[model samples]
Target: MRLFRSLDYATDADPNWAGSLLADGTLPSFRGGYVGISALRNSDVLTAVSIIAGDVARFPMIVEDKAKETIVPLENVEYLLNTKVNGRLSAYQWRFAMTVNAILTGNSYSRIVRDPLTNEPSMLEFYAPSQTEVDTTDPNHVVYRFTPYNSGYTIVCQQEDVLHWKFFSYDTFTGRSPLLSLGDEIKLQEQGIGTLKSFFGGGLKGSVLKAKGKLSADARKKMREDFERAQSGAASGAPVVVDDTVEYQPLEVDTSVLNLITSNNYSTSQIAKALRVPAYRLAQNSPNQSVKQLSDDYIVNDMPFYFEPITTEAEMKLLDDEQRHKFKIEFDTSKVSGPSVQDVASMKTNGIIVGNEARQKLGMKSIDNPDMNRLESNLNTIWLDQRAAYQAAKAATKGGDAHEGNSHDDNAD
Candidate 1:
């Protein structure tokens, strides 16, 4: 009832928690330092994130006028993106791959590298900085350093000259990787997986052997060799009864191994939630959740938030005054979720979109017919029959009244 009554939740008052309260966020990692993007690939959850990001990044980003809602190309931004980014990666690959890497590591960098002779920037060069250092003296100036792929040396550059994109940052300026949030659990899971594998794979601790008699170190090594010799591709790793020089008694830790496996499987959902993805999408089943609902959640929540930081940063850093006024970049979410059956029916019934439009969206070619663009007359004639009958009766009555006046005038004459 009084959860927020005090900020001090723990009585132990560990410095870590106290420090987090004052600091914007804390860096958490499986090791002493930050987990590299390459290292995160070892995780199933992180792999799923890359898959999801690929799906999102394939959807083309179009420049449009906010007022007209029509596509506008500003200085070949769309064309440049289509061919390649900074002349290194295709638009699709760069946007999607970099976004996935950014979500996992909370870092993406692009610089406005200019031609030497001209002051204007000729092209953009994107870099994935392995590490960055901020000059405390000047808040605006920060440095990014990373090694080029297959290069022996590291390249260092300034942040002001680069376009920085990130996700899940506590402070808007510096993004923190969401992987760090579950770093402790991930480390535990990593160890658990290793332990389970070792137990099954006849690793060092496969079993605790109890020998019958005092054996020399040479005898013990021979016994291990025989055990491995018989265990290759076999259903079981039980020790072979050879010479009776040693008797092995295995540890009864089956229950512990089973529990660890179950926990690891269940944690798939936790990882999916942290990445803002539905568990079901990652091949993890969720009872009572339909495909449509999960797909809706994908477009509604996952995709937008995934692109929020990128769009915001690009708008602020990339756009000049004139371009900002006339053009803006947006991902067409229509690629993610199309109109549902009920939605399409409603749109058709209400004549909101024409037949050609619907057909085109449904992947069918348009028909060369006049009615394809317009709603059928029957759609607008639901109440017209009754209204027409009432109008006919009223018009007849007026005509009879006019004729009666003519007859009365003739009688007077």
Candidate 2:
């Protein structure tokens, strides 16, 4: 484990020797395409990242028993995941933040703090991508160099002490940011957004003023300003007292003409694809698809890419060798794509699940009655064997009791 150092020579030290630019004192632009973390200013990027992170945050990791093939909850892991990760954030907020960092920067790092006596993991302290660097100089013993935000010192630790999640990594050490690859698309989106802002921000409707004769620079400038003022506000309908040299031709403020909206949509779609999120999830119109279809597409196609690595990393790093052999960690996505009401009802009716299990899935309270917990038969909630026994008992009671009553009635008569 490593701790803070003196800041006297920290700034003077060249970060190049530290490996990647992430070791720099300032947050460097990730791959020179977009500003690091500032790329979230683009609405599509923000939306995509939020969707993935939020989905992951909703479900905590579950520990599985390998030999029994069942999920078993570990109290410490459960508390760490469901209650709190460290002093700064709860489990949900921490997970969301880490996921956002991973999606945007292609890498997320967390220092694993262990108990001194037990040597078991006690806490996970998250580090920003900008503050963390991979020291790959030693191929055999790769280590992590972490510089805390706004701090004057750096900490160096072994690979085992840090949990690293990499996305789209060519080198096994660091992951590549998605923005680096989607540079063109992001540029197109930014340009379209700029054009839209100019269109709306400027009071002018983008109409053209034609001058057949060559006008001086000052005259041309004056004419353009006059034309814009005339076309907007109360003066819009007023007749312009321009000489015959100038003619005003009104241009419609049509977004279709500029193709900005179309280009923006295309850019957003491409970004969604790059992030492995559905276009609809980024607020793109999907008139043809239902909400359920879009949700299913997201859960089936995109979630695994974002979630599997995190869970796998947790299983490997959070647990010890002895524990790893018998237990594994997994995200509880059962509720994410759970069965529909009709499916749950059918399962209960057909005895595939008991009433209590059905109630839990449906978010209903469990019944205390023993009969409600019993397996139901396909016919009217009674088991086939129980129904048969019930019918035989009723038939014998009817036969003997009715005969006895008739004999008593005859004797009385």
Backbone clashes, candidate 2? 0
* Window of ten residues with lowest summed lDDT in model 1: 1-10
Write one digit per residue (lDDT tens) for candidate 1, span 1-413. Answer: 01111345333323243333222222432243324454354566666677667765776666667775555655446654455666567777777766765665666666666557743445666665443332223456555554555555655666545667777766555665666665565666667787777766754335545567787999889867777676566556444454464556555665765675756665566677777877777678776867877787778778777766666566655566676777777766653466765675567667777776666444344587888777643434446568988778889999999999999999999
lDDT of 1: 0.61
- Quantify all predictions' global Cα lDDT against the true fold: 0.61, 0.74
lDDT, residue 301, model 1? 76
The TM-scores of all predictions, comma-separated, are: 0.66, 0.72
CA shift at 386, candidate 1, in angstroms?
15
Point out where model 2 deviates above 4 Å. Answer: 1-19, 22-35, 201-255, 259-264, 287-289, 341-413
Query: Which candidate number has the best TM-score?
Result: 2
